[model samples]
Target: MATVTYAFLCSGVGLALCERLLSQDTERLRLCLACRNMHRAQAARSALLAAHPTAQVDLLQMDTSSIFSVIRAAQEVRLRYDRLDYLYLNAGIMPNPQFDMKAFFKGLFSSNVITMFATAEGILTQRDGVTPDGLGEIFATNLFGHFLLVRELEPMLCHAGRTSQLIWTSSSNAQRSAFSLEDIQHQTGTQPYSSSKYASDLLSLALNTHYNPQGLYSSVICPGFVMTNLTYSILPSFPAFLWTLLMPLFWLIRMFTNTFTLTPFNGAEALFWLFKQKPESLDPYAKYHSLTSGLGNNYTQPRKMDIDLGTSESLYEKLLQLESEVRRKVEEKKKEAQHAHRHLAGSVSS
Candidate 1:
């Protein structure tokens, strides 16, 4: 039997979903840990090997936030493997996150408390910035960069006889109202994280529609309220001990809604579940959520996403346009640099 190849983009050390996924069946799986930080990637690879010495784990360096880095990574992937079975678009960011204590208190007494916690509707906002590529950092890191990677690796992903799956780590916080086609990058918004996630859902649906005939499948998942580095940044003012003390309160909230899958292992439930499923058997319109019950049992549930085919297609087109613009700019810069180098060399010789 051919071994299954799984490439995870931006695998977090210790709290990564890839670690749990690899632990399940390391011998049969060829794991690729694609991350920006070589130090963290090496650490993650070591930890995985330590637990399962026989596991086949490889590393690729790529910062999903940078367009140039993504291009180089795609080239490396093409050279390394002929075909990729699963591409876990799991890397994401929420820069300068600020929790709304006032809104949290008000919502506690309101009927929307559960909704607020589950979806983080009015209780969370993030201050986003621009990337070196001149795109919104959150949008680029969370959505467009992955989109570009998928586009670049289309040959491997869309095989004639076999199917490849793109599993995106989206969120329950992805609200329809947060996304705007007019401002797709959320350049002027305080909630770029939410906006970008919503865009992922739409883009997934679009990918299925466009590539299903060619055997490429796309699906999105909500790793429900996982307490990773991203979550820790939200309430940085709260000491680690204080956050640990609030575990009971969070557990109590879980009884009302099971979306609070706090640990990365629990949050990865849907991602692992998707691995065992047939891509064609999945629902494109649903956002698969990783839920942990009050009893601490973890399971994957699919909820209908608040996106339509029309909107998804529109977003897909917008992404294509942005991709073209960025590529063009990159080429122009390369040419300018080459010209400047030649001029300097000529002057030096003279």
Candidate 2:
């Protein structure tokens, strides 16, 4: 409807946006959703059409763990849109997630310790020594994959007459102490998930530094806590039927902190705000924390948190280098693929 190109990455919470946008009087926005799986994307599409039958929306396959996938995804985006209005990088994971029940029970007795260590906000653990692109699993999927997408799509981003923004889906549980430059990959006994989110924070900050001058802006937001596939990973392996027993309490807590495992809808608050705000108008160095005290009402607010600007800047430089190297590799591979095709064609002609 609107010419605004909104790429809702992972769009797990896109239903709300679709409803709100479709209700608007103007048909001035078109959507491109980047998702890891096709089925989920199609289901989302079906739901959207049920409400807004004429919505111009398409889906593209993207697995952030794969550099090649990011490249291909960007290529697809470039093919469709000459200018991008907003990019909400809402896709994230806590692979192999495990909760420390001791910590959870302890927090339960205290004031809604919203960011307690053992909640759905648990750090990441990947399958040992595996990545779609052969990089650190967490780093590759959670950070580098999005990083490469922005790089490859820079042209669509920096179009002369349009406003563009980049959004990073961050979390309130992020701690400065959890991240270390020496162990950026989190391979040295640190929580890989935390380090990766920290990297997302840094990358968003870095993006403002590098590209804002060229008319692009980036900001990061933390969705307080949400109950999604990513959260169920930490729900103790109790019988599913038995856990359904907690539904009443879950809804009660969702009233207090909104992290009680009903659903992750509140987590999209920061994301929703950034969607409507100017990127340069936000603090790149801040962790835009989302707070939801759902006390019979959903209250979503953003407050700045402590961050290291020095580390954020340094990480930016490293990412630039990585982006450059990846581009080189992609170029080399393109040449090889082209050459192989030409040789095969020559043999057939002979």
Candidate 3:
């Protein structure tokens, strides 16, 4: 049997999907936790090992928000593994989120209440910043960094006879109108999170178009509205105690819409489900969603995405261009630092 290697980006402690995925078949998986913080990654590894003493779990230091970090991490991964079977692009961020209480209250009384709750449309906005890579933080963390990593690992992912899977954690909040090919980074938008996710959905389709022949497959999944750290950050003013108190109300909302998969384990259903599927048999145009019924049963379902081949291909080209530019900038910065260091050394010697 081929040793199935699974590398998860940004999945640490409290990440329900990582825990659930490991619980299913710890003995079968060769799991690698790719995270920005080594301390947290160590903790996550220890926890997993505690649960399954014989499970193979490793760690890689990677910060998806930083291009330099991603590049270095990808190099390390290439050194460690001969072939990668599954790459989970699960690292994401929604910075400086602001919730619109007025809109939420008004929508509660409107006919579109269910829609509002399901998608959180018009109910949330976020302040985005540029990363050191000169890319939008949301765009870098949610999509571009993962894109770069995939490109770097193409050699391992695309082999002669074996197939590799790229699964992205996308969201229902991904809106068609929010993303623009010209502003692929969403630099000027308050909905950077939404725009970034929409771009991922588009990029996944494009990846399938370009890499499928090379034995690499790409797919997107929505984990629904799970009350993870990302979700809690939306309403930072709401104390953890208050959120705990509101659990009953959230459950009531869950009854109205199955998208209210309030827990991380439930939110990870689609990701775990996709692990069992044949990549060729899956629909490239569909977004797999983790849903929960009123009785709290978890299941995965596929919903047709709003993306088309033309837009996907267009976005893919734009990303490749950006990738080239970013790499050039990184190289130039390295050269400048080297020149400065040499100048200082010469002056000191004189």
lDDT of each: 0.88, 0.70, 0.89
Local accuracy of candidate 3 as per-residue lDDT tens digits, 73-170: 99999998888999999899998998999999999899998788778899999899988777889999999999999999999999878789999999
Give the clashing residue pairs of candidate 2, or none: 1-27, 1-28, 1-29, 2-27, 2-28, 2-29, 3-28, 170-222
Lowest lDDT block of 10, candidate 1: 10-19
Residue 103, candidate 2: Cα error in Å is 3.8
What are the per-model C-alpha RMSD values against the true structure? 1.5, 3.1, 1.6
Q: Which residue runs of candidate 3 sit more than 4 Å off their true CA positions?
A: 12-14
How close is every model to the real structure, measured as TM-score?
0.96, 0.86, 0.96
Query: Which residue pairs of candidate 1 clash?
Result: none
Tens-digit per-residue lDDT, 175-242, candidate 1: 88899999999987789999999999999999999999999999989888777787888888889999
Would you give me the overall lDDT of model 2?
Answer: 0.70
Minimum summed lDDT over a 10-residue window in model 3 is located at 9-18
Ranking by TM-score: 1, 3, 2
TM-score of candidate 2 on Cα atoms, chains taken together: 0.86
